[model samples]
Target chain A: MSAAERSLRGRAAIVGVAESSLGEVGPGISSLDLIGQATVRALADAGLSKSDVDGLFTHSAFFAQPVLTTAEYLGIRPRFADGTATGGSSFVGHLWHAAAAIEAGLCEVALIVYGSTQRSHGGGLVASGAALTRSWETPYAPRIPASAYALAAARHMREFGTTREQLAEVAVAARQWAKLNPAAFVQDDMTVDDVLSSRMVSSPLTVRDCCLVTDGGGAVIVTSAERARNLPRPPAYILGAGEATWHMNISQMPDLTTTAAQESGRRAYEIAGFGPQDIDVVELYDAFTINPILFLEDLGFCAKGEGGAFVSDGAIAPGGSLPVNTNGGGLSYCHPGMYGILLVIEAVRQLRGEAGDRQVARHSLALAHGNGGTLSSQVTAILGDESTL
Target chain B: MTDNVRADVESLSPETAPGTVFDRYAAEGVLAYQSCGDCRQAVFPPRVLCPSCGSDDLGWEPSAGRGTVYSATVIAPRGKEPYTVALIDLDEGFRMMSIVTAGDDGAVAIDDPVTVSFRLAGDEPPLPVFAVEADR
Candidate 1:
């Protein structure tokens, strides 16, 4: 094998990852309070206290809203705080930002947190929220994200031979994974027939194709390789990361069948110096079942139009060659509005050898990718074994 | 409202208060987009300021609303089923997502010819939609 054969395997590490309960924790808990609990748990998991955290990154629907005043309530003043709101994609973007900050020695440890009360707060569609309301989108029928995403799903069916069954396969696999996850919401070992028979939300995408609505919070702590040696568990090193945007609104996107994930995935692979073949596991944001089908092709796991087939034959299952969404995923796991953060936490646990039953075989490299705002944005993060660093 | 922005049935209006451009176009029966002077970019759902260059200098230019069907889906959810959403590429070089009023005849191909129309979603202002243009 030539020197070009392999790329740099490991670099940064995730020392701690935590989340509040997957189910509704009650309306008594505000989004900020959930953030506080998740953040504290993450710090404890890393064998550190809130005082040890100097960096904070958050993707909030309530960014400037009064509920985001967590720094004061937690009593920890982080020197770095990023409130980047790229829809659900913000979590993956935050992971990349934290990795860069730690690598630059700007912060010793970074805590990226996300919290939402979807059940009680009535988490509005990502597009209807304050974040996505630009001049053009608001005027056009409120740019319902479900309707917009429905539009994209329709296009995919028109262009390629992607079928409703293929879309159902994604939901089926997710629900199967959910069965193993004690925290999952819907776990009936669904079949394609069950998915097809389910009620429709926007067309093409049935209710089952869409993610769950739960009130919860998730957080993860990232640190440099040197700082991780003292942690309670081995860290999941940051191997590569990348992010990109296609268009502000669904209507303006150049191509809906494909996502910005192609460019983002390519850039991430280049930075990590690894290709798709080297990845042992994947955690893609499945806000809609169609998302995984589109992303698998864009991420270069399979050829275009083959996503329908790629999802079939149990290829993405736990024992499959590529185990995706091992923690039940947004489709099964808790999708408290921003489901991307949960993907990162799950990957960190898998890499740290913490997943007792859902763990894949000797997983050394993993990829976490997410989509934001009707597939308007995308971010990819790669993790590896600590020893590779 | 450009003349082409009118509803296909000659009935519904997409907006409650149609903008000056849309009103004028509705009267004239023409389709057009806003062109920004700063970046020379074409903006759909026309805007006063250029999103690319932030230039306030803008002008209305005629649009063919003729392009290919980039991608489409037929959503059959419980309440809403059997409706199509297509991404249309305009002759002026911009893409937009809208409901396809007609069936997916061969006319809805990748590079099909579509003429712009206004869609009335309930009572809100009519929205810009596209259909297979008839032969001239």
Candidate 2:
């Protein structure tokens, strides 16, 4: 990429971020409605109008054509409409694509949005249905998503000497952060023991270890750095971004403990001209407790097989050295099916010093990592304030 | 199953989707996997092309039904019976998802040796499962 020379580094910045009605939205609200709500709010936050959006990026678990549906519902036709999706973290990948589009003069003022009603629908994981690809494992009826994540956690413990207590530490840290967030849905005080005794949905992963099933939608407004700086609010520049996926399903993953985050984070850091040491706040997709642990290692925050130690002793807690998932994260915050875009919202808020009580002291450099599928798709984005620009 | 050996069987492509072929063989008490002709790489849920080398040339071979549990988890679905699910690292190098009959919930652990067996419990075709067994 460096050889190619032309880079998207600091070429684009996130001007605005907003979330729609979070938690359960009940029967009247649909996924598209949430997108409309969030998009309108984000545009206002950017001090821009709906017509300013010439580019659109969105992905949905239930929609056949996300971009088309969102564009039609929002009544804003865009020259660049992308529905290219892998999974939840699809929006984080959109940041990189939007930056490239801006640099190529393809489109300006790109909108990345996502919404889900999985919680109001069933309030639990959508059960795995019978399929050809899943034929190998569906017979046993492993309560997918959770069971797949448990497989990785179990393998990590076996290979790295990671204990259940360590995995619990990840959940505890997220809850502690959630307590400080007024908008966070779950604010109840939680401990490592509470996570351990929360009824094992899967052998190692208790029900509490899984992310919250809620209905929510989020939107991020991205434009060239020149346009972003003039906005009403301070800009959270897209310093660098990268996306990677190694497998489509958990069974096909080459290694259970490690994820594609290693490659994604490396590329992101390389393009950003920095590493984890320079980051102040970290917002990672925590669909499961083990996720942050695996991502911390793969994302270069700590050594491989040392994620357990890195997250232990309240290392990622609010007052800890490295603040991660400050907005509660998917573990305690609203999951809303794909919680990737929501992560960027938190990072941008931290960069803009709008996180309120949950704000970390250093608001300059931030890292937001999103994981999709069963820890399959990983997208890393390094964001910073005007100081870094 | 034993009762529907000659019953209606739908046609399916082994490369695009290998469920039918694997089920047919599982019904007859055999566990088969594909080996890439070019890379000699073991392929599971049989694919047409070699995932390792992109060569469409592949061959089918029966597994010894022997493997080690790469990872295992006991899924307790509320009131339902708990069972150990695992990813089995076959001797041939391919890994697959299956169940281990550990007799009790949470009995199976990672690195346990297991062998595949067939079970026909639902209206669908027979599927391969595993039971703890000693193997080198």
Candidate 3:
């Protein structure tokens, strides 16, 4: 079923997008401080005040009662609050929830926020005590997040003959994009050999194949499309949004080679009345190198098992047919634990024609997809210029 | 059940969680999984309700302890002994993730036939593992 009949379609628009100073923010700074800084900057960018926000949406793997904490810290009692913690894609999911809230007259403006001090606090990717899977799966081997993705990568290579070079191309392309983004954590030039030769975290996944860990935070303001016209920047109209969760643990995944993006993307496209060929820019979560490849295939950008060849020869580079992750990605951009929020922020910037160096020729329609857990949860947000609304 | 194979298995204690029945069976050197009483369908990592039929009437049943390797990865950290982790599709119908001991060579591949084994670490009960079938 599609959201064609739902009023939420084309009803909400992103009015503001901003990020805290990327890269190292030092040890004294906490995630709460980052959230406050980004929230103020984003609200200012939207030409809205903290009092204008009646809805709040945020998630934290490290902090408990995050939505309440943000509300109390920001000192704005929100009528609507959502702390839907589904890993990195929580922010993308929040967009859909906020849109529904606005359409139902529950709230006028919503603030979606995320922050992490993983680098400054020496926090690892998987929160130290967060038990993701069953106890049975943990004793035999360490259950680090990369090892989980490594299992899927191994299965995909065995089933489809995907080579290491193809996976390395993802890292290389991300670096090329990062070179243009001043806020990117690592903009150094890299080659396929550099990725292939990096220290192996898991079989078939090198350190380069993994995303960088840094302290960063980002926020976006969403409100009714009618109110967005009076805002400071061009509003990125929300054409369609979809989210799904097939499994929580990698072991329980029905198919290792495919992710839930198939269902989420299909729903989003059906609602938007558009297809893969129509997307002008794409920002997909790249927590691992294998993620974008799987998302490309599962989202119907390419045929099944053909993602290896689809991404070769700079297909996703800045001047390519489909520009993906224009502000770099989790692979090169800042990955403050959950990288989903950053994806939507970049999509909004691209759709608004604000992406300075890595802007695509046609910036009307953009698709931002986020993968949470071990490719277990998938969320797709289709943003477009106000003209499309 | 193989009672004489105590030393060959890991001696870790069963986790005191909702699904310790699976661990109880593992500690006894018998591989068992939960089966719904209504649908007779197998469920792994034991849950209170059957995912397919939504029946809470579940019972434990012994498995043949054999399956194929759905996927495998060698996690070789620096200065550490490398071990192979795999997702084994059990013969009874459920899939599980566990470490694989492919003899001294530690050689394993996808779709290889495997048999269930057990290993102990610290004070925890024996955890189920997989080993490639010798003839395969």
- For model 2, state the Cα shift of residue A156 in Å: 0.6
Residues A79-194 of candidate 3: C-alpha lDDT, one tens digit per residue: 99999888899999999999988988899999999888888887576372456665656776744688889889999899899989999999899999999898899988899999
Off by over 4 Å in 3: A2-5, A126-134, B1-18, B103-105
Model 1 DockQ, alpha carbons vs. true complex: 0.35
Each candidate: RMSD to true structure? 6.1, 3.7, 4.2
Residue-level lDDT of model 2, residues A106-174, one tens digit each, is 899999998888788878754322354445566678777899999999999999999999999999999
Model 1 lDDT on a 0 to 1 scale: 0.75
Backbone clashes in candidate 3 total 7
iRMS for all predictions?
A: 3.8, 0.8, 1.2
Candidate 1 chain B: worst-modelled 10 consecutive residues by lDDT: B3-12
Q: Chain A only: give the TM-score of model 1.
A: 0.93
lDDT, residue A364, candidate 2: 97
> What digit string (tens of lDDT, one per residue) describes model 1 on residues B1-136?
3333322223324442225555466345466677766687987766556668876666667776677666655555445435556677787877776656564453244555677876555755456677866552
> For each candidate, what is the lDDT?
0.75, 0.86, 0.86
**Candidate 1 CAPRI classification by DockQ:** acceptable
Residues A160-186, model 1: lDDT tens digits: 878999888888888877887777777
